[model samples]
Target chain A: MLDGFAGGFIEILQIATLMTMFVGVIAGIVASAIPGFTITMAIVLTLPLTFYMPPIQGIATMLGVYVGGLTGGMISAALLGIPGTPSAVATTFDAYPMARKGDPGRALGIGIFASFFGTLVSIIVLVLAAPPLAIVAIQLGPWEYFSLIVFAMTVIASLVGRSLVRGLIAGLIGIFLATIGPDPMMNSPRFTFDLAMLSSGLPFLAVLIGVYAVSQLLGEVEQMRSGSSKGEALIEERIVFRPLSYLMDTIRRPINLIRSSLVGVFIGAVPGAGGSIANLLAYDQARRASKDPDSFGTGVPEGVVASESGNSSTAGGGLIPMIALGIPGSAVDAVLMASLMVHGIAVGPRLMVDNPEIVYSIFVGLFIGALMMLLIALSSMRYFLMVTRIPKHIIVPIVLVFCAVGVFALNNRVTDIYLLFFVGALGYVMKKMDYPLAPLVLGVILGPIAETNLRRALSTSEDLTLFITRPVSAVLLGLAVISLVVFLRHRMRPRASADS
Target chain B: MSDPRSNNASGRPDRPEDDAAPQPEGISGDSGLLQFAFNLVMLAGFGYLFWEAMALPESRWEPLGAGTFPRVLLGALMLLNVIMLIQSAPQARAELGHGPRQLFGVAWRTMLEFRTVFTVLGAFGVFLILIRPLGFVIAAFLFAFGVQLLLGPRTWRNLVISAIIAAVATVGLQVFFAEALNVFLPRGPFS
Candidate 1:
């Protein structure tokens, strides 16, 4: 067993491992620092380039990008008051305020520390939860799996803002796109439009980039054009590391860590919802629990602590379902799932029995990754903070270029570039029209699973009512109906009130 | 970059939910035009998707035809557009009365306000194009330096420092991917 671990990853343990770590740490910092340039987007864009590399290194590089992107967001949120990604939004409520109050150093310090703690807790949860979850997954027939997808889609509870109709429309659009490519059952093509590339359907990464990155970029462009000062100053008077006392204080607020970590883990376990909502829920909980609730939006270090910890911890939480059920729980996890498949690493229960080394390596990597983040965050704090001084004008173009390169680098087909721009235009138009992008993304990710599984489940039963006959499927379908109704009700109430 | 730090942080109540909420304010000016343009585009996209779906070959499973999902999507979209049109019906008058003032107001405001944001996005796009052909190391290094420059960090010291940082970062990533994870870096023209 030791030999398996040793032999398979022999190339990694040498100097190359150190180099990869360095790259990951640096990439993490940069991607995190840049607003709207998410780790998932970065990894997706870079993955195609990795096609030329050996499997292990390619996976490691992407993994490095993942870790880097996750950790890097704390830098901007704490120092500059901007959350680089949705996950970091909670971090901004406290970190930015703390930075402004002249303790940017303290805010950043506590954030990194809390992040480490939350991550540690999550890793433990993953180790305990993965195998059991995998076992339970064995019971999931196509009917059960379809029901689970229905349950996942029900997460529209969180996404359904005042504009539920618009959100649903976007989601339906995503499902339609999922109907593209070939049918798994009858070897029939669904919506190929006679185009060969479309036969494979829309690349998940392209859709992801379009909805998440391009739409965001366009929105940013609009926001930038609205006249604002480009003034620069360091709100933080000092930046240093004094860890022990802070650790003790965090321990004192054990409930904060635990509550937020649990929120992260649960949300992570739920497919499609991802860390964005977890971080938000954690931030809300932190505020509700604070001795001074008003202090939250104004920049309490506790707010920063809860949020950074909550969101970062979801990395571990998200891996649970993917490893156990072969169902990706977030975009990054989805990419990781793809990587595992690329490396011929089977997911689900069989993987547990067959590949203990890979599993153990992952467990070890999670532990080591968290430690690396702490050390890297501390040493790189000053450098990351300096990013705030870089003007917006320069940053946007660079990001756009990276997106272009990243998109094209994947699959070396020039057609992907055309797809990127087409999707970009679609994204720009969508943003202009005020349609939410998240549902579209979640739908695209979850659609195929829902559709194919539903068809298969129905096929087996020869009964349309079979969905309700099975207890688990019936319950899941019930929940999905109830959630959709609830969301629609929420939407209707607002419009009725507004009109009245 | 409005230094979100300065936004009335005296433990003040949030700037009213309405400000943050998506409610349309005073049905005049750019908002109206934007609404119209977007409405038309969405209408067309949805229409095309629906049309294409309907044209697809039918299967034995009638309800679950290839075009079923797309048709359903377009139907929903068309309904949404109708609702949006109703909401925006009041703005029709503003369209007829308002001249260049309203349009320019939104344009000029965006231009002056988000200059930094524009530069950043633009430069990033350029960096991506240059990267594959130029090699990851050089492209990344140049990209970071370019961003710093566009952000107005003009001194040679700042430029050189950022360049070194970018170079180190690119090399570090390359080494990690190539040696440790076994990812091969694009040799580009350098090799």
Candidate 2:
């Protein structure tokens, strides 16, 4: 391992490799900072570009984009109250409010530091525990996956703001929305309503951009009309950059940072779940564990730290399965595996034995890439913050156009853009009614996964009791019940006290 | 075990002063009527979907079949919407106590209050419709320029700036995606 690391370090340190990695990181950051652009999209775009490079250099460059994209997502999430990627949704819960409260610099600074540390932690875990972790993850069956999703669904408890019923309704609506295109198990249509657009179903990206971005922009318009700042920028406060202090602020909550990163790593190691689930799960756990949980969504450093760290750690965690077992953890990992395959390098259990240099190069490259991302983010943060200075009237329309273009670019489908408009309107109405949107988005993401697993598990056996009999599934279900109970008890306590 | 955060969960003592305003009952006043109406529409929608799902072919191979999951979700949604309707019924009744003209007046005032949002949303809708016919650049430019003019100060300088921004964003984005990213946007006649 040491020899491999030494060899990898030398390869990555080559000026050509280092320069490409730097550019890849910048491209990743810029792509993910656009609301409709995703990390997967950025990596997919980078794939063909990397085909000409050496295997190690190509993988290293993609790794740069992976790490950079994770942190870049929080930039727009904090600045605009619109998550740049689905993974950054939890970041907006607090970071946007922090920015709105005149501390955009602090929010960005803390997020960058948290993301840096999170990558480091996940990399350490990946290096030390990859093989064993991949084996354990692969052992999980359909039952375990379904139960895990049920446990994830319990996070709606934390997101339900004032009313639990409304939150559940929103979440259920999202699940139903996911069921629109076609039934997961059988390709038979369930709710197409005979419309061509509905025939393909609502794209998750469109739902995300519409529910969050478009609704958010419309809300900004309403605020402009009502507030005194008719022609003013998003933030009028004088911005300050205090990177060192925010670093201390993030590190001071060492427990939250570590816990969130670990959550991210575990979720990323799971085959299907990725940073989108990790960010929310980490934020929920942080809130549940905090001394003052009520401050979670109110622009606290803890929320930003939890979310950014959680998502960033997934970059390292996602590489684990690909490196150890040749099983791609997510779409980005699949693209990386494809890049390696293009170089005639087989990626599987024998990968370390066959190409220890490549494995070690990846390890070292991640560390260097993370460091590069930190330097790039810190120095360029001031320019990104200039976004806050763009007047709302100008930024709103431009971003809306960007949103449309991004959605259109997703599949080059004009129908998807049309779906964005209607979804945006529904999201606006839902927002106006005080319904929490997070659970809805979460439901949409998890819905298909949950249904497919449930059906798969049942098809394997007619006995539903196997779900409880299986040790892992039982534990997961137990955890879900406990989570629901704790949330209920927490919610009821206030009303109980007021009555008393 | 008693959670430390529970004591302040509802009161949220740590919330910033600006956010400390009393939380509105989501089912009250004009908003209550809106919620009530929204729930009614949703209930009908869920009901219709549930019926549609019931007709989905049940696979003999798999026990659960295609429609089972959606049926389960739609059932839950219907139940939740019903619960929301019941909860909001009292406030909605009070709002309806006012005559039709009064209700109409309140609705008009609410619409006027959100006139800007409605206008922008309408313009966005038109932009989406025009994308295929007029192409991305032309449609996006028109939408951006028009919305900016409508929203921003409508002075001559602002109009020129809006026009410049609209042109740059639409054209620059098209070129960047096409040349750099290789994802071609719709060109319509420009194609």
Share of true Cα-Cα contacts across chains kept by each model: 0.13, 0.47
Runs in model 1 deviating more than 4 A are A1-115, A126-131, A173-200, A210-365, A462-464, A478-500, B1-30, B58-63, B97-191
iRMSD in angstroms, per model: 7.7, 6.3
What's model 1's TM-score?
0.66
lDDT by residue (tens digit), candidate 2, A292-395? 88888788999999999999999888888989999998888999999999999999999999889999999999999999999999999999999999999999
Chain A TM-score of candidate 1 vs. true chain A: 0.65
On TM-score, the candidate that comes out on top is 2
Task: Tell me the tens digit of each residue's lDDT in model 1 across B1-191.
Answer: 11111122111211122222222322211254566556667778778777876876655753354555556767887888766666555554355356667656755765655565556555555655665588666776676667655553457876676666566666776675566434455567884
Q: What is the lDDT of residue B161 in candidate 2?
A: 96
Tell how far residue A433 is off in model 2, in angstroms: 1.1
Measured with DockQ on alpha carbons, how good is candidate 1? 0.17
